[model samples]
Target: MSDSKHSGKHDREMLLEMMHSTTKTSAEDLLISYKGILYPSVLCCLETFQALETFEAREDDILVVTYPKSGTNWLVQILYEMVSIVHNKEPLLDTTMIEFGSPEILARFKDRPSPRIISTHLQFKNIPKSMFEKKVKILLVLRNPKDTAISFYNFHNSLPPLPSYNSWNLFFKDFISGKVCYGPYFEFVAAWDNHFNDKTMMAITFEEMKVDFPTALKKISEFCQLPLNEEQIDLVARCTSFNSMKEQSENTHGKLGDSFFRKGEIGDWKNCFTEDQSKVVDEMFEKYLAGTKLGKMLNYAKYCKW
Candidate 1:
């Protein structure tokens, strides 16, 4: 078992190296080389930085993980609704008990209630070891790659201190290279894929979440071990829709961020990618994602595959 685990880790590292070749220069690396060329140093730094040192987890903790621009906010909303439904609690919007700051969230293992739900964009290695070791529940949400990249590009552009968008082409290049934070999506997804199990963890696709909200709610309900009645299941489904979240976001003054619904429509990538551009991306996705188990449950259009 140990030899196989080490072998798996070795193979995973090699795969990340290949993906890193396509990543872009990060904010920190730009100071060293103002030139557009990307260096491997950025990848090295990420692997090192992502290696979490001190770690811990409580048995009852619930974690929702996703690459950036995936359905993180929606997952958070879903879990919130789950708690509210199962426990007959009030709406979660006006309280910090359910939602807290980044620092507060990382320390979730410290002082949280039973059946804790915490959402994070942290890469696999950055996660607390105790959680995986103790078999804590983790729900990974994935979206389609093209849409994920597009959503991330738009999200970064919309940030207060906007940076690059040399063109969709350059962004595409850097994206494949794994230069962007919380990317390349395939690597993040694959590296953590093996840890999944019905007991400790489960991987659910955004397309699944999109196609049938009620079914998605059902899966989450089962994972949470709180059986829901017909009415509660219906409410959970209604609560996670793009329209409903958008309404909440507006009411909250958009404070929830793009995690709510960056853009709900499927195939929005068609608008952003020309025929040639789409062709390039398809090639990139094939090269990067082929032969991974992550591909089986993920079909580019098989709902929103990210």
Candidate 2:
């Protein structure tokens, strides 16, 4: 066989293996290789990993980084408006998460113009080194662990090939133990938090963004050096509000799934977590974050009660 044909055959075999193995009953069966990294065996495949590694970075690239279910889509839309205003461009740019393993994101990014705004759920360590070396801007958004866990529980239940915990108790246990996809919550937050001092990175909290939309927009604009006037900032805030985004999700992005826009409110965990579950999460938070600067900074204990 020709070399090109042989390569195609090999790629097909790998993809088939990944899909077949990913469908297994246990979570351990779902890992696949990409750029030598072990990614959860879910929506992404080998091609997705290759695209992530091969993706080139522009000097002005803006990355929106977050743990899963932590206000990524909301922030991306807000940043999208800021970038659109700055460039005065038409047919707005795509801001899909790189790690989503979407081929469309790969295609759009490869050909898109400079000053691209991309989002990702990859751990800080997995982000492309070129981004760091070039001092590209990174916006890290975090949420209190309780809300994040509840949001993610609903998210995973909708996605197949990822174990759907029928019981909240099982899901809660898995979440506290960090057995889900994308690894542990504490580690992901800490890895990015360590870069808080980097001139290129800015961290924001979901609760803060919820409480103060205009302030969040102002901070984000300034962090990216986009400098929107008060009027423009107000416009962006109104357009990207949780209600606005949730209503526009389907019309704007096509079918984004029911869970994607779910309860974009702070403290939704109150409805989901029982007294015992809340306590378990509190214990995990204390155990994992104790003595760490991030722990001191967040003081999650203040928000422990459901």
Candidate 3:
């Protein structure tokens, strides 16, 4: 075989080896390693990974990117409502996240009309290259790592396909080590830091949204160019509130249920993270995110400090 073909064969072999190894441990079985990043095997398949390489992004597409449990669903709901206002109709929400489905499932999106809002938990490096080339508008949602970790732990336990930990301590070890799906929280934040200044991207924190929903909604409307009037914005705010979403969870999330709307608070991590665990996350933050522009945007001292 030619050199390029030989390398492709080797990479496939490595992926298969990693998948097989997952069967040996409960923690390992929860995620599959692909190109050095872990993804929930239950939701991602080999075909999905291959399809992402060639996924087409349109110029008008609005991509909502976030690490897992970083308020992705909440942001999507807000965006959907904004779109509904502009079109004067409440379109049924498309919650099939980009990287979580098969290539065949992803192919279905091509038929959807323009101004599509696509959501994904994929890391920066894994996003389709076509997105950058097309200059698609990206809205990145960030959460303080401590709260993110705690939310992630609860999510895993509640979802049947995801692995459940016997205790938070066991999950904490995997999380801090970057062994969870989508890899380390610190690295995920740092990777996106490179694009903080991009004209096509807007970075918003979950804490910021919780503190001021209307202001955040206005920012999103401006970023999306949807230009909702103040009255429309207020209506969307009331409809998408945490309680409203939680009550509608059965219809919105289907089998996933209300776990998607649990708590939605900023500092729930305090109840779950031990003193040492908190320090570990703090040091990791210091090492990877302390001086970066994204870190500043997160307001680490205010939101992440214990």
**Strongest candidate by TM-score:** 3
List the candidate numbers ranked by lDDT, top first.
Answer: 3, 2, 1
Candidate 1: tens digits of C-alpha lDDT, residues 118-192: 666666766767768878888888787878878877765544322447577777777777767554666677677
TM-score of each predicted structure versus truth: 0.74, 0.82, 0.90
Candidate 3 Cα misplacement greater than 4 A, ranges: 1-25
| Model 2 stretches astray by more than 4 angstroms | 1-42, 91-93, 102-108, 290-293, 296-299
- CA deviation > 4 Å runs, candidate 1: 1-52, 91-105, 161-166, 251-260, 301-306
What's the lDDT for candidate 2?
0.72
lDDT value, residue 188 of candidate 3? 88
Model 3: ten consecutive residues of lowest lDDT: 1-10
Report the alpha-carbon TM-score of model 1 versus the true structure. 0.74
lDDT of 1: 0.61
What are the lDDT scores of the predictions, listed in order? 0.61, 0.72, 0.82
As for candidate 1, its clashing pairs are 22-177, 23-177, 23-178, 23-179, 24-179, 143-305, 143-306, 144-304, 144-305, 144-306
